[model samples]
Target: MDVSQRLSFFAALFKVHENPTTGMWLLYITIVLLSILVFKLGFAKKLPIIKSAVIYTFLILGCTVLTFLGVFLPVAEGLVVAALILIIYKIRLHQEKKEQAKAE
Candidate 1:
């Protein structure tokens, strides 16, 4: 192949993925991490897990409602929301134990 053709072939091989689904999934994960960071920084005095969970759930639910209003796909929104809920639940459980310890 000519140099132009060879260069084009290599360029195609290095091209970024254009899959909207995959990109959306990645965006969801990034948002989750950002939410976690926000909770960590904002509620450092609280139980780590509890703060994380509350922030995560709130953000996820907000995102889900937005998606329902035709912002994104249901599947993507569901997965992200589920993740957020799970994180919040874990944190809440941990906080309960810590509070009990304080009481005792």
Candidate 2:
């Protein structure tokens, strides 16, 4: 298969193979930021400072692996989609609650 065809969206956008260090780091940062946003918006629950720190530390470590997978898979793209879906769901949920409050 063609290399261009196999590269993931962010990978191709950053030209990972062409720029090696810079591109890979940029791709990795993109994946990490997206993953953190998704986790905060969709999955995180309030936690104490230490616990939150630990969780994020592990999450960043996990993103390193994700960065590798993201080169060929749509991992970052999937995270972006997931984050958008969560944002929409949260907005709708908040509106419903507000409407119910007003009706009460």
Supply the global lDDT for candidate 2: 0.93
**lDDT score, candidate 2, position 85:** 98
TM-score of 1: 0.35
Q: How well is each residue in 12-86 modelled by candidate 1, as lDDT tens digits? A: 232213454554455545445554554454454555887757866787766544433322223344444666776
Best by TM-score: 2
Q: Work out the TM-score per prediction.
A: 0.35, 0.95
Model 1 CA lDDT for position 59: 77
Q: Which residue pairs clash in candidate 1?
A: 49-91, 50-91, 53-88
